[model samples]
Target: MNKKLRKWFRGLTAGKAVHFLLALLWFGLTLFPLYFTVVSSLKLDNEIWDTMFQLPSIPQWENYFKAAETAGILSAIVNSVVISLGSVAIMIVCVMMSSYVIARRLIKRAKALNLYLLAALMIPLQGAIVPIVQMVGAVGGKNNFFVLMLIYVGLNISISSFILVGYIGGISREIDEAAAIDGCNLFQTIFRIIFPISMPGVATAAIVGFLNVYNELPIANVILTKTENRTISVALLAFQGDYQTSLSLIFASIVIVIIPILIFYLLCQEKVEHGLASGAIKG
Candidate 1:
């Protein structure tokens, strides 16, 4: 009977191994396009098409430099960085402060404020495109990095604030009251005590906000008229045409754009998950 059971267990294990192998095959199939991009980026014009299906003979390290130099990508990279970081900075301050007030019930009319915040969250950015463009146009920040930063910040606030408020609400009220009894005012208690504790939630919100701003294309497309001010996502369009397609450069440029996001995720994903698991959501 024991030998029969052992044989059954081995059969189950073999079945699981087959399933795992199938899953891995599916994963590779999914990742094929991304792999093609990286490999194609390392090949030249004819080299790209002629050997489109072939692996790289030699790594094309110069594609990185060539793409940057040819596409005015240096300026785009700088613009993208400025816009992303600037948006993140503004988001951190406003969302953190707003979430704190909502979480702590600092406003006497908390219900009204909560309703307002919820209303804002429900209003999608795409729906506001018309008025947003007019406002941005009227304000005359066309093609400016500073203006793009403001546009990004205003657009992202609702969802970021909502998530942050939920995290903040999870924090125990006893801590706030304790700090108050110890001669700490609302500002001090918020900044000194609550804010530090909410760093994880704040990090999570900031990273999401940063990714949104960095990857933004529509608003940037409408607002950014100058080549110098265009974000990398917008600038990647430079490699496309009706007849002539620079597939190699397109692949290289895409790799350049994706690499930064991958790096940021690798570094900050731990902090983000840590904050989500803990109650440190508002600051």
Candidate 2:
């Protein structure tokens, strides 16, 4: 046992030891917030701040029930899901088609068009929220989820385009030729062949677009003025008030809000990782 321990210690080179320590640190950092939230969510209001780092004496499962009831969590979750999935679906379709066109240089001045679309990246959409709100108001589109979905798609277009274009560009032209020779039309070729081959990129863009739309607050808050139409981010504001706040409830709500997205990320994590790695290499 002593000899084995000595061998194991000797095997830990400086670089390996440093890396292990860093990874351990990162793991702790990543879990700490979740631990804090879980503990705080179970405690009394005063206990949350006072014993923040400690576990609750008695776990208050009622906090979840209270949060769900008070915040309309189910409704908000449903709204977020509908809008997020709808927005990402639309975004993926638009981004993939546009990216393919750009990547294949199929359209006139495709590079110029790509650059023009990408220019939106430099302009912060949040900075122009006044005009956006005005434009939506002018159209009488407030509380309309379809309009919000469109806005989400528009906001995400630039980054999605960048990612998809790079990934699609990396795909070989020979595949297009093969599809053509096999009697596939442009639409068929793109959807059947290119789309599958470039799924990693699509997954990457979808994840990004979903996260953006789901967590969006200012626009959702303004547009979805009705309590019934509110998304999770907007609904969270119910817990916070000017004079007093329910910190425990807020943590409970947070835990509920994060569960779906965490599940989503876990499901798509493999594809997303591949997409990012390939995109980096391709770019």
Candidate 3:
């Protein structure tokens, strides 16, 4: 019995060792580009071409300063933050209300509405660019920040609502009944009771929506033609010239642009993961 137990323990240890090796390989592959970017961003323009992976002999921190000044990174950061947060707030409120109503079957055609929303998930945003651009122009929304915000909200609402619906369905209906018994109206019950319970789903939707809006390039590129109105992703174009691009400046700017989202994800990673798992299981 002791011999058998020892063999079992050995097998478990070997399995863990194999898993660790695989995880290390995956981590290296995932980290390589970011590491290369950071190292390249610090090299002098002349030095950058010397070795692909070698560490710079002398770090050129001035590349960041140049990138910031030339790219108008500060203004772009402000624009991205405002648009992303505003769109996320609008999306959450709209998605939560709509999802709750549908999940609870409060309306006669709730199923139909839910079906329609779910169907929209199959449509890619790329296909709608031309029509959206034309519509924005017809409505005189070109180069408008608020118009961009509205577009972000509209594009994200369907998926956010879909995620919330599944999670909201998993919540107890008795909670709504209880809220209603205590003199809560529809909006009150949803805001005070249901919304609080569905936070995991909300967190997931918020993160996803924020990332999409913040990193979105194509829509922002086409819609925001003015330099002053550009978001971070669109503003990166400043580093590119007709004949040549500034590699060091571009990479430095990329590092700056990536920091905020990386911090946000790190802070809320647990919530995001939990939300995704719960939504998937409930869905």
lDDT for each candidate structure: 0.83, 0.93, 0.91
Q: Which 10 residues in a row give candidate 3 its minimum summed lDDT?
A: 8-17
Select the stronger candidate by lDDT from 2 and 3: 2
Off by over 4 Å in 3: 1-9, 13-21
Q: Between the candidate structures 2 and 3, which one is better when assessed by TM-score?
A: 2
TM-score of each: 0.82, 0.94, 0.91
In angstroms, how far off is 91's CA in candidate 3? 0.7
Q: Write the candidate numbers in order of decreasing TM-score.
A: 2, 3, 1
Model 1 lDDT on a 0 to 1 scale: 0.83
Which of 1 and 2 is the better model by TM-score? Answer: 2
State the lDDT of candidate 3 residue by residue for 34-112, as single tens digits.
9999999998777777877999998899999999999899899999999999999988988988998898898999999
Give the alpha carbon lDDT tens digit for every residue of 1-283 in model 1: 9999889777777779799899999999989988889899998878887887788898788988878887888788788888899999987888888888987787898767867877887787789888878988798878777777887888888767766787889889999889989999877887799889878788888888888888888889889987777888888888888889787788888898888788989999998787666533333
Candidate 1 Cα errors over 4 Å, as ranges = 1-30, 45-53, 108-124, 277-283
| Ranking of all predicted structures according to lDDT, beginning with the best and ending with the worst | 2, 3, 1
Q: Judged by TM-score, which candidate is best?
A: 2
Of the two candidates 1 and 3, the one with more favorable TM-score, higher being better, is 3
